[model samples]
Target: MRLLQKNKPVIRFLLTFFGSYLILAFLYNLYLNNASSQKYYPEFITHIVALQSQDLIEAFGYETKSIPSDYDPSMRIAVNGDYVVRIVEGCNAISVMVLFLAFILAFKKDWKSTLLYIFAGLVIIYALNILRIALLTIAIYEYPEYTDLLHTTLFPAFIYGVVFILWFIWIRNFRPKTSPKDV
Candidate 1:
Protein backbone atom coordinates (compact mmCIF):
# COMPACT_ATOMS: atom_id res chain seq x y z
CA MET A 1 0.00 0.00 0.00
CA ARG A 2 2.82 2.39 0.81
CA LEU A 3 4.66 1.51 -2.40
CA LEU A 4 1.46 1.96 -4.39
CA GLN A 5 0.92 5.32 -2.82
CA LYS A 6 4.46 6.34 -3.67
CA ASN A 7 3.87 5.35 -7.30
CA LYS A 8 0.38 6.75 -7.61
CA PRO A 9 1.20 9.28 -10.30
CA VAL A 10 3.01 6.74 -12.46
CA ILE A 11 0.21 4.24 -12.00
CA ARG A 12 -2.39 6.81 -12.99
CA PHE A 13 -0.44 7.77 -16.06
CA LEU A 14 -0.05 4.16 -17.17
CA LEU A 15 -3.74 3.49 -16.74
CA THR A 16 -4.71 6.58 -18.67
CA PHE A 17 -2.29 5.85 -21.49
CA PHE A 18 -3.30 2.20 -21.82
CA GLY A 19 -7.01 2.95 -21.53
CA SER A 20 -6.89 5.70 -24.14
CA TYR A 21 -4.80 3.57 -26.49
CA LEU A 22 -7.20 0.65 -26.24
CA ILE A 23 -10.27 2.78 -26.92
CA LEU A 24 -8.70 4.60 -29.84
CA ALA A 25 -7.32 1.38 -31.34
CA PHE A 26 -10.71 -0.29 -31.06
CA LEU A 27 -12.39 2.63 -32.80
CA TYR A 28 -9.72 2.75 -35.51
CA ASN A 29 -10.13 -0.98 -36.18
CA LEU A 30 -13.86 -0.40 -36.61
CA TYR A 31 -13.10 2.38 -39.07
CA LEU A 32 -10.69 0.13 -40.98
CA ASN A 33 -13.34 -2.55 -41.26
CA ASN A 34 -15.85 -0.09 -42.66
CA ALA A 35 -13.49 1.85 -44.92
CA SER A 36 -11.77 -1.25 -46.28
CA SER A 37 -15.06 -2.61 -47.57
CA GLN A 38 -14.87 -0.02 -50.34
CA LYS A 39 -13.23 -0.79 -53.69
CA TYR A 40 -10.03 1.03 -52.88
CA TYR A 41 -7.16 -1.17 -51.75
CA PRO A 42 -5.58 -0.56 -48.31
CA GLU A 43 -8.47 1.70 -47.25
CA PHE A 44 -8.89 5.42 -48.00
CA ILE A 45 -6.08 7.01 -46.03
CA THR A 46 -3.41 4.54 -47.16
CA HIS A 47 -4.53 4.78 -50.79
CA ILE A 48 -4.30 8.54 -50.56
CA VAL A 49 -0.85 8.26 -49.00
CA ALA A 50 0.25 5.96 -51.82
CA LEU A 51 -1.06 8.38 -54.45
CA GLN A 52 0.59 11.33 -52.75
CA SER A 53 3.86 9.43 -52.43
CA GLN A 54 3.62 8.50 -56.08
CA ASP A 55 3.18 12.17 -56.94
CA LEU A 56 6.24 13.01 -54.89
CA ILE A 57 8.24 10.27 -56.62
CA GLU A 58 7.15 11.63 -59.99
CA ALA A 59 8.28 15.08 -58.89
CA PHE A 60 11.72 13.64 -58.24
CA GLY A 61 11.98 12.68 -61.95
CA TYR A 62 11.04 9.04 -61.46
CA GLU A 63 8.13 7.49 -63.26
CA THR A 64 5.87 6.06 -60.59
CA LYS A 65 2.49 4.40 -60.52
CA SER A 66 0.31 2.62 -57.99
CA ILE A 67 -2.19 -0.12 -58.63
CA PRO A 68 -4.59 -1.95 -56.33
CA SER A 69 -3.00 -5.21 -55.28
CA ASP A 70 -4.96 -8.35 -56.14
CA TYR A 71 -3.01 -10.46 -53.66
CA ASP A 72 -3.95 -8.42 -50.62
CA PRO A 73 -5.68 -5.27 -49.43
CA SER A 74 -2.76 -3.08 -50.40
CA MET A 75 -1.46 -0.84 -53.17
CA ARG A 76 1.37 -2.11 -55.29
CA ILE A 77 3.74 0.77 -55.99
CA ALA A 78 5.94 0.53 -59.00
CA VAL A 79 8.82 2.76 -59.95
CA ASN A 80 9.76 3.03 -63.63
CA GLY A 81 7.44 0.03 -64.30
CA ASP A 82 9.03 -2.32 -61.75
CA TYR A 83 6.92 -3.23 -58.76
CA VAL A 84 8.98 -2.18 -55.71
CA VAL A 85 6.77 -2.11 -52.70
CA ARG A 86 3.25 -2.52 -51.41
CA ILE A 87 1.59 0.23 -49.41
CA VAL A 88 -0.34 -1.76 -46.86
CA GLU A 89 -2.87 -0.44 -44.34
CA GLY A 90 -0.06 -0.43 -41.74
CA CYS A 91 1.86 1.97 -43.93
CA ASN A 92 -0.85 4.56 -43.41
CA ALA A 93 0.58 5.26 -39.89
CA ILE A 94 -2.75 6.00 -38.25
CA SER A 95 -1.91 3.46 -35.60
CA VAL A 96 1.25 5.36 -34.76
CA MET A 97 -0.71 8.59 -34.64
CA VAL A 98 -3.19 6.89 -32.33
CA LEU A 99 -0.33 5.87 -30.05
CA PHE A 100 0.99 9.43 -30.09
CA LEU A 101 -2.45 10.75 -29.22
CA ALA A 102 -2.79 8.39 -26.30
CA PHE A 103 0.46 9.71 -24.85
CA ILE A 104 -0.57 13.32 -25.29
CA LEU A 105 -3.95 12.70 -23.73
CA ALA A 106 -2.41 10.82 -20.82
CA PHE A 107 -0.76 14.09 -19.87
CA LYS A 108 -3.95 16.05 -20.47
CA LYS A 109 -3.95 19.81 -20.32
CA ASP A 110 -6.47 22.47 -21.24
CA TRP A 111 -8.86 21.26 -23.93
CA LYS A 112 -8.20 24.12 -26.36
CA SER A 113 -4.45 23.76 -26.27
CA THR A 114 -4.62 19.97 -26.24
CA LEU A 115 -6.92 19.83 -29.26
CA LEU A 116 -4.80 22.28 -31.24
CA TYR A 117 -1.62 20.42 -30.36
CA ILE A 118 -3.19 17.13 -31.36
CA PHE A 119 -4.26 18.55 -34.73
CA ALA A 120 -0.86 20.06 -35.44
CA GLY A 121 0.99 16.94 -34.32
CA LEU A 122 -1.24 14.72 -36.46
CA VAL A 123 -0.60 16.87 -39.54
CA ILE A 124 3.15 16.87 -38.95
CA ILE A 125 3.15 13.12 -38.47
CA TYR A 126 0.92 12.53 -41.51
CA ALA A 127 3.00 14.74 -43.78
CA LEU A 128 6.24 13.19 -42.59
CA ASN A 129 4.76 9.73 -43.13
CA ILE A 130 3.92 10.57 -46.74
CA LEU A 131 7.45 11.82 -47.32
CA ARG A 132 8.90 8.72 -45.64
CA ILE A 133 6.95 6.36 -47.90
CA ALA A 134 7.92 8.35 -50.99
CA LEU A 135 11.60 8.17 -50.14
CA LEU A 136 11.37 4.50 -49.17
CA THR A 137 9.75 3.67 -52.50
CA ILE A 138 12.56 5.41 -54.33
CA ALA A 139 15.21 3.80 -52.15
CA ILE A 140 13.83 0.33 -52.68
CA TYR A 141 13.64 0.97 -56.41
CA GLU A 142 17.27 2.02 -56.60
CA TYR A 143 18.67 -0.49 -54.12
CA PRO A 144 16.78 -3.70 -54.68
CA GLU A 145 19.47 -5.68 -52.84
CA TYR A 146 18.97 -3.58 -49.68
CA THR A 147 15.20 -3.88 -49.67
CA ASP A 148 15.14 -5.82 -46.40
CA LEU A 149 17.54 -3.43 -44.73
CA LEU A 150 15.66 -0.35 -45.86
CA HIS A 151 12.14 -1.65 -45.29
CA THR A 152 12.48 -3.86 -42.25
CA THR A 153 15.15 -2.01 -40.32
CA LEU A 154 16.12 1.47 -41.48
CA PHE A 155 12.85 3.14 -42.44
CA PRO A 156 10.97 1.76 -39.49
CA ALA A 157 13.71 2.98 -37.18
CA PHE A 158 13.66 6.41 -38.80
CA ILE A 159 9.90 6.90 -38.48
CA TYR A 160 9.78 5.56 -34.94
CA GLY A 161 12.77 7.74 -34.12
CA VAL A 162 10.83 10.76 -35.32
CA VAL A 163 7.91 9.77 -33.12
CA PHE A 164 10.22 9.40 -30.14
CA ILE A 165 11.61 12.85 -30.82
CA LEU A 166 8.12 14.29 -30.96
CA TRP A 167 7.20 12.56 -27.74
CA PHE A 168 10.36 13.85 -26.07
CA ILE A 169 9.61 17.37 -27.26
CA TRP A 170 6.10 17.17 -25.92
CA ILE A 171 7.10 15.91 -22.51
CA ARG A 172 10.16 18.13 -22.04
CA ASN A 173 8.83 21.35 -23.54
CA PHE A 174 5.07 21.03 -23.45
CA ARG A 175 4.43 18.87 -20.43
CA PRO A 176 0.98 19.17 -18.88
CA LYS A 177 -0.14 21.11 -15.83
CA THR A 178 0.50 18.39 -13.33
CA SER A 179 2.65 20.26 -10.88
CA PRO A 180 3.31 23.94 -10.24
CA LYS A 181 6.60 23.66 -12.09
CA ASP A 182 5.00 22.04 -15.15
CA VAL A 183 4.25 24.09 -18.21
Candidate 2:
Protein backbone atom coordinates (compact mmCIF):
# COMPACT_ATOMS: atom_id res chain seq x y z
CA MET A 1 0.00 0.00 0.00
CA ARG A 2 2.81 2.41 0.86
CA LEU A 3 4.71 1.57 -2.29
CA LEU A 4 1.57 1.97 -4.34
CA GLN A 5 0.89 5.32 -2.72
CA LYS A 6 4.43 6.45 -3.29
CA ASN A 7 4.31 5.49 -6.92
CA LYS A 8 0.85 6.67 -7.82
CA PRO A 9 2.02 9.28 -10.32
CA VAL A 10 4.41 6.84 -11.91
CA ILE A 11 1.69 4.22 -12.02
CA ARG A 12 -0.70 6.65 -13.60
CA PHE A 13 1.88 7.64 -16.16
CA LEU A 14 2.52 4.04 -17.07
CA LEU A 15 -1.15 3.28 -17.39
CA THR A 16 -1.80 6.28 -19.59
CA PHE A 17 1.14 5.59 -21.85
CA PHE A 18 0.43 1.88 -22.28
CA GLY A 19 -3.31 2.37 -22.58
CA SER A 20 -2.98 4.93 -25.35
CA TYR A 21 -0.30 2.88 -27.06
CA LEU A 22 -2.49 -0.24 -27.05
CA ILE A 23 -5.52 1.65 -28.30
CA LEU A 24 -3.61 3.31 -31.15
CA ALA A 25 -1.92 0.03 -32.01
CA PHE A 26 -5.25 -1.76 -32.01
CA LEU A 27 -6.75 0.80 -34.35
CA TYR A 28 -3.77 0.62 -36.69
CA ASN A 29 -3.99 -3.17 -36.61
CA LEU A 30 -7.65 -2.97 -37.45
CA TYR A 31 -6.77 -0.76 -40.41
CA LEU A 32 -4.10 -3.19 -41.60
CA ASN A 33 -6.48 -6.10 -41.12
CA ASN A 34 -9.16 -4.46 -43.22
CA ALA A 35 -6.59 -3.36 -45.74
CA SER A 36 -5.24 -6.89 -46.06
CA SER A 37 -8.34 -7.76 -48.05
CA GLN A 38 -7.60 -5.14 -50.69
CA LYS A 39 -5.65 -5.85 -53.90
CA TYR A 40 -3.68 -2.64 -53.70
CA TYR A 41 0.04 -2.55 -54.45
CA PRO A 42 0.72 -1.31 -50.95
CA GLU A 43 -1.66 -0.60 -48.14
CA PHE A 44 -2.89 3.02 -48.06
CA ILE A 45 -0.21 4.78 -46.05
CA THR A 46 2.56 2.50 -47.23
CA HIS A 47 1.57 3.24 -50.79
CA ILE A 48 1.86 6.94 -50.20
CA VAL A 49 5.26 6.53 -48.60
CA ALA A 50 6.45 4.35 -51.44
CA LEU A 51 5.28 6.83 -54.01
CA GLN A 52 7.00 9.70 -52.26
CA SER A 53 10.19 7.72 -51.96
CA GLN A 54 9.98 6.85 -55.63
CA ASP A 55 9.67 10.51 -56.48
CA LEU A 56 12.69 11.34 -54.35
CA ILE A 57 14.72 8.56 -55.89
CA GLU A 58 13.77 9.71 -59.36
CA ALA A 59 14.67 13.28 -58.54
CA PHE A 60 18.18 12.09 -57.83
CA GLY A 61 18.39 10.69 -61.41
CA TYR A 62 17.72 7.05 -60.53
CA GLU A 63 15.16 5.21 -62.61
CA THR A 64 13.15 4.37 -59.51
CA LYS A 65 9.69 2.90 -59.56
CA SER A 66 7.25 1.59 -57.00
CA ILE A 67 5.11 -1.15 -58.39
CA PRO A 68 2.76 -3.75 -56.96
CA SER A 69 4.18 -7.19 -56.49
CA ASP A 70 2.10 -10.02 -57.89
CA TYR A 71 3.69 -12.50 -55.50
CA ASP A 72 4.22 -10.27 -52.46
CA PRO A 73 1.87 -8.21 -50.34
CA SER A 74 4.38 -5.37 -50.29
CA MET A 75 5.10 -2.77 -52.93
CA ARG A 76 8.17 -3.71 -54.94
CA ILE A 77 10.58 -0.77 -55.14
CA ALA A 78 12.87 -0.97 -58.12
CA VAL A 79 15.90 1.18 -58.64
CA ASN A 80 17.52 1.18 -62.06
CA GLY A 81 15.31 -1.78 -63.02
CA ASP A 82 16.34 -3.91 -60.06
CA TYR A 83 14.05 -4.68 -57.15
CA VAL A 84 15.98 -3.28 -54.22
CA VAL A 85 13.42 -3.21 -51.45
CA ARG A 86 9.85 -4.07 -50.61
CA ILE A 87 7.81 -1.30 -49.01
CA VAL A 88 5.82 -3.31 -46.50
CA GLU A 89 3.40 -2.25 -43.76
CA GLY A 90 6.26 -2.21 -41.27
CA CYS A 91 8.14 0.26 -43.40
CA ASN A 92 5.42 2.86 -43.01
CA ALA A 93 6.56 3.79 -39.49
CA ILE A 94 3.05 4.19 -38.16
CA SER A 95 3.90 2.01 -35.19
CA VAL A 96 6.73 4.31 -34.21
CA MET A 97 4.45 7.29 -34.60
CA VAL A 98 1.94 5.59 -32.33
CA LEU A 99 4.63 5.20 -29.70
CA PHE A 100 5.66 8.82 -30.07
CA LEU A 101 2.09 10.02 -29.62
CA ALA A 102 1.58 7.82 -26.59
CA PHE A 103 4.63 9.13 -24.83
CA ILE A 104 3.70 12.73 -25.53
CA LEU A 105 0.18 12.18 -24.28
CA ALA A 106 1.41 10.51 -21.13
CA PHE A 107 3.22 13.68 -20.22
CA LYS A 108 0.68 15.93 -21.82
CA LYS A 109 0.77 19.64 -21.08
CA ASP A 110 -1.78 21.84 -22.86
CA TRP A 111 -4.07 20.42 -25.48
CA LYS A 112 -3.18 23.02 -28.07
CA SER A 113 0.54 22.58 -27.63
CA THR A 114 0.26 18.83 -27.28
CA LEU A 115 -1.82 18.33 -30.39
CA LEU A 116 0.35 20.65 -32.43
CA TYR A 117 3.48 18.91 -31.22
CA ILE A 118 1.98 15.50 -32.02
CA PHE A 119 1.07 16.61 -35.51
CA ALA A 120 4.49 18.07 -36.11
CA GLY A 121 6.20 15.00 -34.73
CA LEU A 122 4.12 12.71 -36.94
CA VAL A 123 5.03 14.70 -40.02
CA ILE A 124 8.69 14.68 -39.07
CA ILE A 125 8.60 10.94 -38.60
CA TYR A 126 6.75 10.33 -41.84
CA ALA A 127 8.93 12.58 -43.96
CA LEU A 128 12.13 11.25 -42.45
CA ASN A 129 10.88 7.70 -43.01
CA ILE A 130 10.31 8.40 -46.68
CA LEU A 131 13.75 9.94 -46.93
CA ARG A 132 15.18 6.96 -45.06
CA ILE A 133 13.56 4.56 -47.49
CA ALA A 134 14.77 6.52 -50.48
CA LEU A 135 18.30 6.60 -49.18
CA LEU A 136 18.17 2.97 -48.13
CA THR A 137 16.91 1.93 -51.52
CA ILE A 138 19.77 3.73 -53.16
CA ALA A 139 22.22 2.31 -50.64
CA ILE A 140 21.03 -1.21 -51.29
CA TYR A 141 21.24 -0.66 -55.00
CA GLU A 142 24.76 0.74 -54.81
CA TYR A 143 26.02 -1.50 -52.03
CA PRO A 144 24.24 -4.82 -52.08
CA GLU A 145 26.81 -6.21 -49.67
CA TYR A 146 25.44 -4.07 -46.82
CA THR A 147 21.79 -4.92 -47.37
CA ASP A 148 21.43 -6.97 -44.20
CA LEU A 149 23.29 -4.48 -42.04
CA LEU A 150 21.57 -1.47 -43.50
CA HIS A 151 18.08 -2.93 -43.42
CA THR A 152 18.11 -4.86 -40.13
CA THR A 153 20.41 -2.57 -38.22
CA LEU A 154 21.22 0.92 -39.45
CA PHE A 155 17.88 2.13 -40.82
CA PRO A 156 15.80 0.72 -38.01
CA ALA A 157 18.11 2.31 -35.52
CA PHE A 158 17.88 5.64 -37.29
CA ILE A 159 14.10 5.74 -37.17
CA TYR A 160 13.86 4.47 -33.60
CA GLY A 161 16.62 6.84 -32.56
CA VAL A 162 14.64 9.74 -33.96
CA VAL A 163 11.66 8.66 -31.91
CA PHE A 164 13.81 8.37 -28.80
CA ILE A 165 15.12 11.86 -29.32
CA LEU A 166 11.58 13.13 -29.75
CA TRP A 167 10.57 11.41 -26.56
CA PHE A 168 13.50 12.93 -24.73
CA ILE A 169 12.74 16.35 -26.11
CA TRP A 170 9.15 16.04 -24.95
CA ILE A 171 10.15 14.98 -21.47
CA ARG A 172 12.90 17.51 -21.12
CA ASN A 173 11.36 20.45 -22.87
CA PHE A 174 7.64 19.95 -23.37
CA ARG A 175 6.12 17.77 -20.64
CA PRO A 176 4.40 19.39 -17.68
CA LYS A 177 6.90 21.08 -15.50
CA THR A 178 5.31 20.19 -12.17
CA SER A 179 2.82 17.75 -10.79
CA PRO A 180 -0.72 19.01 -10.75
CA LYS A 181 -1.94 20.32 -7.46
CA ASP A 182 -5.49 19.00 -7.74
CA VAL A 183 -6.98 16.23 -9.81
Q: Which of the numbered candidates is closest to the native, going by highest TM-score?
A: 2
| Residue pairs in collision within model 1 | none
In the range 45-160, model 2's lDDT, one tens digit per residue, is: 88888899999999889998788878877888999889999998899999999999999998899999899999999999999999999999999999999999999999999999
TM-scores of the models, in the order given:
0.92, 0.93
TM-score of 1: 0.92
Candidate 1 lDDT (Cα, 0 to 1): 0.87
lDDT of 2 at 34: 79
Candidate 1, 7-124: lDDT as tens digits: 7878878999999999999999999888874556668888898899899999999999899998998999899999999999999889999998999888777788778888988998
After superposition, candidate 1 runs with Cα above 4 Å error: 177-183
